[model samples]
Target chain A: MAGELALVADILSIISLIIGIFFLSLGMIGLLRLPDVYNRLHATTKVGTLGAFGVLLSIILQEGATPMGIKALTVALFILLTSPISGHMIARAAYRMGVKCCEGTCMDEYAGKRRK
Target chain B: MKRRLITYMALPVVWCLVSGYVTIGSLFLGLIFGMIVVEPFSKLYRLDEVVHPTGDWLAKIPKKIKYFYVLIKEIIKANIVVAKIVLSPTINIKPGIIAVPIRAKTNIGITGIANTITLTPGTLTVDISDDQSILYVHSIDATNPQGIRDSIRDDLEKYVLEAFE
Candidate 1:
């Protein structure tokens, strides 16, 4: 039973690692492909966090009783806390500098409302 | 002094349990090392609490769990799509950044939603409005921006509501 459980844990770890890497790669792709800075930021922040979490989760599962699991949990929590705040700061900085979206893009909800 | 002692002692206890080193001697050594090293560093680093979750929202736990289940399923599906794109030789990917209107109000909810978007494959959360009402997303393959926006509005919005609303 112990051996079986270890096997299951190993399989789960492998799966999680693959899933995490996959997300990270996609985020990188979005970063390169997106038309605008804001868009690229979106892809990177969202997908990067998830991918990192997945990889850490797999490590935790594999080392279920080790200090490694605690470390992984700490990293995950830190990423969760920081990534969004960074994204928010980036967007606010861009808007304050008057960065405009693509010409075809519709909806400028922030425009003309506060600008006198 | 007592709080400092407790905080200092926590890591060794965690280390002991994790390492399965239950002997009293080992525990004493680990506790001494942790207090000398880890406790000082922990106090040096500080995080400002910007948003706190109200315990009144505990009633939403069931709904949050259901939403989390759906999100996991979506994440798996997205991973498969991403893998396929990565392996293909054609590399027929069109990337675009699109602005998305966010409905989440509180800072915690907005941040949660943005993080969720970042966690998903093929989408990244780039920016959010100060009012927490808009999100800018970059997509790896954005041949259909409308479809992507709709997915965020519908699927992610549901989970965000459960988690933060």
Candidate 2:
């Protein structure tokens, strides 16, 4: 029974690893291809964060509820906590710098609003 | 009063995680260390008023759990949508910033909503207005501004309000 459980875990870990790498690569493609910083942030903050999280999740699954697994889980939690904040900071900086949106862009309700 | 106790309890929990030691001896040591340092830390930081829960926090646990589940589901959906956008043949995405008027009163609720918007689908929260009445969201697909506003209001902000406010 233990062997079977380990096999199931291995299978799930492999699947998770594949999905992680796929999302990571897609995020890279997005970073390269997207027009502006705001659009690119949509790629990195969401896809990239989830990709890293999935990879860490696979590590925990493979390692079980050991010390290493606990550490991996902590790292994942930190990533989730910090990734969006960093992305928000970058987007705010870009907007403040007057980085205009791509040609396909249409609206900006924050155009003339106070920056406070 | 209650806030200080919770912070004292949290110190040991954080210590256990960081040290990667969940043994009884480790936890006992952690508790001792927490008890010793918590008072000085609180005094230095003036955290008495800061750690207090905004409302009926204990009663919101079930709602908070539900919100967490929803957030996870939205994250997966976001990834799938982003993957499709990136993989498509023609890169035709209308990206722009739109002001999303918020109804969340608490600071924590507003921050939670902004963070949730950034983590979900194609939206990234650029900034909040001075009065905290508006959030500037950069959405990859801004063809229909009302659509984005409605979706966030109905799906995301309501959950944040329930959980945090």
Candidate 3:
């Protein structure tokens, strides 16, 4: 039974690793194919967070009772907290500099409301 | 008082577990050290209650799963397109920055939207408005900016609304 449990854990670890790889690759693709800066940011943020989660999950599975797993989780939590803030700051900077969207873009909610 | 005690106890326990040196004496020492360190800092920062309609934990799961699914599909599709572009030797990439109007009001909602954007790949969040109502992004490809905006508005903004708005 212990052997079976170990095998299950191994399988879970492998699965998580595969998922992480998939997310990383998808993030790369979004970097490549997305049509605009905002869209690309969207893709990266989602993939980066999920990719980190996948890696952390694999670590937890592989080192269930180890200090390494705890450290991995701590790293994941930090990523979760800071990544968004970084993204927001960057996006905010871009908007203030007057980046333009495509000509036919719909919904200009901020139109005529620029704080001069 | 409750939060302080919780923080004091939780920090040392977490430290001890993560450090992997499990001893009663060390645990006691760590607890004392944690109280010494954490107590003084706790007074410096005050915690504010930020209420959410969907709650924080549950809001992320479904949206994350959906994003994972969509991202995988997009990756496969993008890989083929990029392969073709690379093989063609024309280097037809058109990069540009675009400003997107944001609707989310709260700090959590706005941050969530921005992070969602950065996670995807080719785009980076460049800036947000002072009022937190606009997002600026830099994209490696800017052929269809509107489509990109709509997609974000549909996928991420909806989730942000559910999560924090």
User: What is the C-alpha lDDT profile of model 3 across B68-119, one tens digit per residue?
Assistant: 5664554344434433433454445565666788888878677767766665
TM-score of chain B of each: 0.67, 0.87, 0.63
Candidate 2: stretches off by over 4 Å: B29-44, B48-55
C-alpha lDDT values of all predictions: 0.69, 0.88, 0.65
TM-score, each model?
0.59, 0.92, 0.58
Judged by whole-model lDDT over C-alpha atoms, candidate 2 comes out at: 0.88
Order of all candidates by DockQ, from best down to worst? 2, 3, 1
Candidate 3 ranges with C-alpha deviation above 4 Å: A11-55, A84-116, B1-35, B47-91
lDDT of 3 at B79: 37
lDDT of 1 by residue, A1-116 (tens): 99999999999999999978978988888667555666556566666767998899999999885667767877786776787678656755775677775434434434533322
The DockQ values of the predictions, listed in order, are: 0.19, 0.85, 0.24
Interface RMSD of 1: 5.7
Q: Give the chain B TM-score achieved by candidate 1.
A: 0.67
DockQ of 1: 0.19
In the range B1-165, model 2's lDDT, one tens digit per residue, is 556777767878777777777888878888899878777777675657645454688899999999999999999999999999989988899888899999998878888998999999989999999988889999999999999999999999999999998
Error of 2 at B141 (Å): 0.8
Fnat of candidate 2: 0.85
TM-score-based ranking? 2, 1, 3
Candidate 3's error at A81, in angstroms? 3.2
